[model samples]
Target: MPAHFRQERTKIVVTADNEVNIQTLTNWKVSVPFLVMLSDSSNITMPITIEDTLNQCFTQETTEQIIHLSPVCANLLRRVTASDPPFKLISVTPSPVGESGEARCIIQGKGIVSLEAVNQLGEHFLLATTYLSVGEYGIHFSTENLANGVYGIILRAADGREQRSVIVIER
Candidate 1:
């Protein structure tokens, strides 16, 4: 997998024209989520950092706070907090458009799985349904004589978990 890094910073300032405006500054709150990826293919999510700076000008007080992520160290955080299942469907890459030649469907997963192909009307066609061990696996299917429409590639794990992806076959 490719690696990605990103850094972001946000600053907020408040000014007081009278006493009432200054009191509202104390009620301000901020929250941020930072993504950190680990070597073991895991991720951590937390707040980066917050810095507060107060400056006194002529007769008014200016308060500024900066929230930023450190560029030196970070990780890839998962967008969803839901726990991952033992068998994960990483991806299903199919040839987007193709002619009457051979079109392929690549199913990637973590554990044992069985794959099948279905039409747009939810009709299951037994393409390749066999138990695959724990790792990444790929299977190739022909598009010859098939209609020019969308077909669904469904992968079922040994534990009964299933993932579906669609591929378009064009004449």
Candidate 2:
């Protein structure tokens, strides 16, 4: 028989937000599950914190269940919450800039009403600046090829909502 043939698996119950409430297990070993609490409903970029479920029991099955929690979600959430205003820089994809490969700074805000992409010179590069809808906004900049420098992202809404972040490009 295999070395692990005699062990049993534990069953765990979790909430929609990835909160684990250990239900039962043959053994008592436990590994903590990751926690993900939503701070901003509009932008799912920020995270509250990184935590593990209490290991009340000490069984192989319980340990394995807690280890099953994905680390990516925990890490990302940690970065977002590191700052006063929780948000994240989604990505900087290539965009059209007078035939040059200009990267567009994509930002994920938390329940934002509107957003804008500006350069160091305080110029608006993306068109249709306002986020008419209450979801992800794609801002395309039609400026000269961005040089190796830094850019700014300003998120704002008529309801006095605002968020700011910076993006830097090497190429």
Candidate 3:
């Protein structure tokens, strides 16, 4: 199992245009779900922190059931809907960039612009930019130029909607 699938939901703090403090994956299609706060929404005010529930989707009926079970979970689902977690990945066959079984990752979303991987101590890995696509970003993630164990992912949106999420980069 991957931390993105379990572990404490990545914490996203929405400050007053102040700055998104860090912390934090991809692909053989690893899903990095994030509930981002859009700047265009009239209903959104600043300084609101959104925690937990990344890359989660639920229909209205399902949402109702979740609410019945746990109001906290239901509220998270609603927040995730407002900013919609990135894409579940359209598709990737035999490595998006690296050779077959080369441990590749692709973080695809409309607003995601930059991607970074960090280790347990918040140390960043020196990533090679060769595999990066023009629009659809791809990373040839590995344990060499990067760390071995699981790390945190820091993804920033072009619209200034920043999010923090967990990812398991296993060799």
Candidate 4:
């Protein structure tokens, strides 16, 4: 017998009629909207087990794809470093690229701060919180396996100041 996991309005169940195995097939059809809505409505988060089925129902659809927006003061000096000097994002390159590629950028300005990459929702996709040495700095990122989308590089200095740079990626 197939069992279904349900909570509230969401219904998740495993059926014996589902495609079991096929070495000749190349693709399988799935309903994204239904899955998302069902998953959302249910309390089941992930790592679901399909009892009696060898293959688990693992899906990457819930993965987040974000667009990073550049902050207004990305190029402005916001805080001074330990040397009491101002800091800012001088320049960044390869503004956009596929997620399976690399993007390089250089930041020039006085004083040193922290740096990172953030999504459109202002969430840190990649955090480079380490303190930088004074003077110009260059940051190289390798998003070889990251989700295809847009992101922003955020930088902060010793004086608790911050900056942002834009980056876009596609599959």
For residues 48-132, what per-residue lDDT tens digits would candidate 2 score against the true structure?
Answer: 3334455432233344442233333222211222223323334434522232322223334433343445677877654335444
Candidate 4 — worst ten consecutive residues by lDDT sum?
A: 33-42
**Each model's backbone clash number:** 4, 10, 4, 4
Off by over 4 Å in 1: 1-85, 97-112
Clashes of 3: 4
TM-score of each: 0.39, 0.32, 0.28, 0.36
List the pairs of residues colliding in candidate 3: 24-152, 24-153, 27-105, 33-55
Sorted on TM-score, best first, the list reads 1, 4, 2, 3
Model 4 clash tally, residue pairs: 4
Residue pairs in clash, model 1:
36-75, 36-76, 37-75, 37-76
**Higher-TM-score candidate of 1 and 3:** 1
Rank the candidate models, highest lDDT first: 1, 4, 2, 3
- Candidate 3 weakest ten by summed lDDT: 21-30
Best by lDDT: 1
Off by over 4 Å in 4: 1-85, 98-112, 127-129
lDDT, candidate 4, residue 148? 58
In terms of lDDT, which candidate is stronger, 2 or 4?
Answer: 4
Superposition error at 17 for model 1 (Å): 36
Which candidate number maximizes TM-score? 1
Q: Candidate 2, clashing residue pairs?
A: 28-57, 28-58, 28-59, 29-57, 29-58, 29-59, 32-53, 42-111, 43-110, 43-111
Residue 1 CA displacement from its true place in model 3, Å: 33
* Candidate-wise lDDT, in order: 0.40, 0.36, 0.33, 0.39
Per-residue lDDT over 38-127 for candidate 3, one digit per residue giving the tens place of the 0 to 100 score: 321112322222333642432223432211112233334221322333433222223222321122233333433444557788787533
Q: Is candidate 2 or candidate 3 better by lDDT?
A: 2
